[model samples]
Target: MKIDIVSVFPEYFDVMKLSLLGKAQAKGLLEVSAHNLRDWTHDVHHSVDDTPVGGGAGMVMKPEVWSECLDQLLGLDTSAGADEPSISQGPIVIFPNPSAPLFTQADASELSGAQQLIFGCGRYEGYDARIPDYYRAQGVDVREYSIGDYVLNGGEVAVAVMLEAITRLLPGFMGNPESIVEESYTGSEPLLEYRQYTRPTSWRGLDVPAILTSGDHGKVDRFRRDEALERTSQLRPDLVERLDCSQLDKHDRAKLGALGWDLSGEHPRRTK
Candidate 1:
């Protein structure tokens, strides 16, 4: 997979060079590049942002700079990645903003499969809404997303969050394939396993759960699932609502029934 980031702070991505993503590139599994959007501007100052037109408090990123940078990066008019036939399929363009759609774990999983990902990281105030609006009009698979209810100083942090989330899901990025299957939000439940303790049977004062130490894989698996379900129900009831109860066995159904989860919830009924 290939990923290109367009940001004012190109230096912010230097950390990617020392981590798992860097290793992936070295192994020829992933390719990532970060470019300064201002480099595409024609002005002497290489200006990429300006005061809002209709009356806004902060500066707005100029659409011209974004268009030029994106067009050149994707080889829209030139022979860039043109040799790569998949480039024409279109890049997944993501615009980070507070008012945009909420990004979920499923979105990250889906994006990990894209041939190319192009991130438009906004700075200062934000981009002219036309940036995302125009892409949407072109049938481009662009997504405008917000990390959470809170706002960030810029999109750089959000871009980092998104890149890491997608990268880790790629096949070879994480050495272990099993990690992806058991992790939080990978399947039916969005909740992660509850807190765990290890070794030193008697810690500062607390003891490790005996169920974990018992060498019986069957019991341990059951215990962990129960803990995960309990944690999900307590902390993120919404996630519990999203699980298909029909697939659950008698034990799971009984447990959930006791917790007030009925047949009608956020998820579809299990098929088999």
Candidate 2:
């Protein structure tokens, strides 16, 4: 996939050259380029932000500068009619903001399938609201997302977080595709991944689960499933509540019952 990142602090993206992203680019599976938002500025200071019109604490990114940058990247004619056909098949545009919906693994999976992506990394307050509003009016696939509830100084770090999540899902980006499948929050029935152990049979007096060491693959599989269920129930009951109980077999239901999970719609009570 081709990705274009427009940020005032383009230098912050240097970390993209270090790991899986770097490998993906080297292998021709991905192409990433960072552009300075100030490059579109015509003034001596190359200023990209201005004081809010209604008077706010932080300066807002100037829409005209953002328009120029986006137009250049998309090959659009700024003077053309708003109803005119887009100059190019525009890439999916992403704007990271604290007010938008949360980004999720599902979103990463969807975006990884796109052939092109463009990220607008906002600084100071944020992009003028009109930026996305204008593009969306032209039928462009524009999305505004937030990584979490917290705020950040800028969207540069958010872009990196999103890129890493999306890139890893691309085919051949990961050494083993199975690694993606077995990870938490993936597949039809999402659940936290089972705990893992490596190497030492006995480390600091804590031994690896004997079920793992056992040659009985079926038993090991059952053990892992149970552990995953137990962990998810203990940590994220919300996930458990969303589960399709009808899909569980008698054995699975019995296990959940043992864990005080109410299978009959009433609140569960521990049975000693």
**Residue-by-residue lDDT tens digits, candidate 2, 74-144:** 76765756667465765899999999999988999999999889999999998899999998887779999
TM-score of 1: 0.89
Tens digits of per-residue lDDT, candidate 1, 153-253, equal 88989999988898888887888888678777876567766666667898788888898899999988888888887777778777776777556777777
Residue ranges of candidate 1 with Cα displaced over 4 Å:
78-89, 263-272
Whole-model Cα lDDT of every candidate shown, in order: 0.81, 0.87
Q: RMSD per prediction, one decimal?
A: 4.5, 2.5
Model 2 residue 114 CA deviation (Å) reads 0.2
